[model samples]
Target chain A: MKLETTIQGLCASLKSARAEQKIIGFVPTMGNLHQGHLNLVREARKKCDVVVVSIFVNPIQFGPNEDYDSYPRTLEQDSQLLETVGCDYIFAPSVEQMYGNKPRLTNISVSNITADLCGLQRPGHFDGVAVVVTKLFNIVRPDYAFFGEKDYQQLAVIRQFVRDLNMPIDVVGVPIARAEDGLALSSRNGYLSEENRQIAPMIYKTLKNAEQELLQAKPLDEVLESIKVALTGAGFIVDYVEARSLELQKVETFNQDVVLFVAAKIGATRLIDNLQVKYIS
Target chain B: MKLETTIQGLCASLKSARAEQKIIGFVPTMGNLHQGHLNLVREARKKCDVVVVSIFVNPIQFGPNEDYDSYPRTLEQDSQLLETVGCDYIFAPSVEQMYGNKPRLTNISVSNITADLCGLQRPGHFDGVAVVVTKLFNIVRPDYAFFGEKDYQQLAVIRQFVRDLNMPIDVVGVPIARAEDGLALSSRNGYLSEENRQIAPMIYKTLKNAEQELLQAKPLDEVLESIKVALTGAGFIVDYVEARSLELQKVETFNQDVVLFVAAKIGATRLIDNLQVKYIS
Candidate 1:
């Protein structure tokens, strides 16, 4: 359980693991680990000889108006949770350690995949993710990298870049981890007020209902409108509720595997969740 | 020497080499190998246990109006030259092999440093270079990558991205390979007519004179003007002649390491060259 706070230290640790012919697995996260992140680490532990979990609240990914300054930092609790999950290394680098004094001159942009959904609402978000994740991949040089299906568009974006750039790492998307009430686990959930926390479960429930409606040949636009109405009815300020193909492209109806995506603000905290609906009929 | 035309073939070959703990050195080039490119290979031979040279005339890096279609690709002769230079593998992937039917969705861009000089003249040039070089680095995963200082700005761009991205490979800039008459050897030089070939060496001479003038504390603007006049007098269309800091930023004087860059056209062939001026005073 090594805690590597610098790129040099992380590389040194990884070099040793690589020398021993170990299959390294990487899980990159924005710290404040929840059950969702721990599940990723546990999956890494099951599949790999060494599992490295990075905890950095990437400033680049957040827009100027977004939650960059107030993002959660729970290293003490996050480290404990990761250790309990049998993680081999925790790469928790400071912003200075990662970016230094110079302006970030290098950027990795993935088009098409990043042009819709969360990408449109949060511009430059996935490009920031693309850049940082690339740096992490270069630093770790892992055999496998784990990403949560909870961030469905993010997972798609990563997969797109990995294939287009010909990076030699398998990108595995783990299923979304949800609460007993069906609310998807997110670090941002901590920002929810007690009342909003209770209402957050509706985000997932809306997706489930939308999934059922779509699979039963309901009109895509109608089901989407219902989701917006349901969330807005429950005191959630609907950001976007749309049905997209599994590739995250706009769809008129569910002919193949379609997904229901929802994002909204309950009080000041914004939450996002999506569910895939496979048409059996 | 093995010629690997497919990514799988190259990886399989590299796998056996890595298993034996070989340090790989890479030199990326556009074929029609000249003395400059061969020199790069020879240096790679001297520094690494296994040398892999990639001859990819990357279409992404060339502008629509540029010479991508007409770019000379002498793979047969180039392969022979690489063999002579002790290059262990020539990873010459075809356009189809490198990029399938899909569009190139991933792009790596470097700003600031690429905001001037050749970067200004050719829009999206360094970005194209950035993306292709990143893909090459990912594919080869070399311990060291070599570049010719002849393309000073390109070398600077590569170094910046590799460092900013925290790529493990060390970037080595080999000295510019020159002919007896002082013209920087280039594949583009093949396009020069016999009369233009005689006039081509003037590009190097102009850079040298600019270097001496700047080192002698001459006015930077005056020296730059002289370079343009000298090339224009030789029946060449002077594109730009400017002085920049070694970091490729605009400089007012020769108080530090300065570089004199020149680009011009003779007949239909465009030529570029530069020389470094180390101001000792």
Candidate 2:
């Protein structure tokens, strides 16, 4: 496996791959790889001739109060993990290498998709994702880019902008990978204390319950309210528990496909999860 | 020359060009078939194996009070003019095709460079230029993109964003095309009356005089003030007469290359022109 740490090295490798008519697949990640990230790479391995995984904890995506300083940087171990997954390249660029000393001034924003969901709670988050992904897509020029459905809104925003900007790249969304206990895999899961770790599965459990209620054609409001009650009662600060259409628009009825989204804080770590309800009625 | 009015048609042609290993050059303009626009396509013709010129009258760039409705569009003349200049394709997508009924939510903006000049004069103008050009570049996948320096600040913004976004494009800035009277060629020239057109050359003439003063190391503030006085006395409502470094930053000394920029309105028609002073101290 090749480890490219500079944009120059990455471009050179990509140029030769393009010349040879290789189908390149890309997975961009923040580098504390777990089962979910490995799953994305494995998916890429199944389809593409060359798979590149970019491990960058984008500073611009983090808010002032968010954990920019404490984000993990285990490059050595991350490289070992990716190598086991049939990855061709690990692009791990330093912050300076990616953005340089100057502040990034170009903003690639998607208005509607970013107006709600995590966007409401975290202003400028999706814009950060949009701009950074644009830079990565241009630099890598991948045939296909993989994103996990755990960041469903992010995937939606990326898809929207890729179409809007007419960027010639196909975006693929891999399903969310969860533990046997139903806890969603996340880099921040490392910050969970022993007690909070045990309770974390309750988030997925509640989402599953909400999914069942939604599947049975339960009232959207009552089921969503029950989710908030269940999580808040479990010693969580409910950030939001809401239901929207498959398109992320507010759902008035369960006539079509709908998704229930939840974000809540346990102790100090915030966890988010969503469940899509494919309705029959 | 082929005329492609849809993204699909343009992409198909570009795909074949890439298959044959042809280098593509792009020139983007809003159509009125002015000498300045043709000059840009001519530059692309000399360097690239296939030249694509896009004529898009972007609506988002126009402020509500500005003349989006009155903008001249002569596609027939523009196509003939491009064919004469050796252009390979003329992409003239309808506004609906370029941006669907839905609003284009992506904003590719350069903040520092766009903070002054026409950006201050016309809010969201460069951002419109930034986003639309981004779409065209992706659609064309051009090896080299050409711009006329008649809109000097617009070229600088495009260069900065292309660099910032890591887009693999070589941006070539062709020198401005002017008339015998030294008036910069522009599509907006169609809006001027015969009497106002006769006086419009004053904008360029004043910039030439200002360029002489800067080349001779004249006082920056005094020389700029004289430009405003001369144009205003000629019955033109001066928008701004200022000097900036070649990098588009305010200049305090003539120790480096400097450019004098001017914009003035005569009888409701706004005309802008600029001159560069290659100073050696």
TM-score against native, each model: 0.98, 0.97
DockQ-derived CAPRI band for the predicted complex in model 1: high
Error of 2 at B62 (Å): 1.3
True contacts kept of each: 0.88, 0.82
Q: Tens digits of per-residue lDDT for model 1 on B71-123?
A: 99899999998888899999999988888787778888898998877887789
In order, the B-chain TM-scores come to 0.97, 0.97
Residue runs of model 1 more than 4 Å from their true location after superposition: none
Model 1: per-residue Cα lDDT over A61-178, one tens digit each? 9999999999989899998899899999999999998898977788889888788778888999999999899989988999999999999999989998898888989999999999
Count clashes in each candidate, considering only residues at least 3 apart in sequence or on different chains. Answer: 0, 0
For each prediction, how big is the interface RMSD?
1.0, 1.1
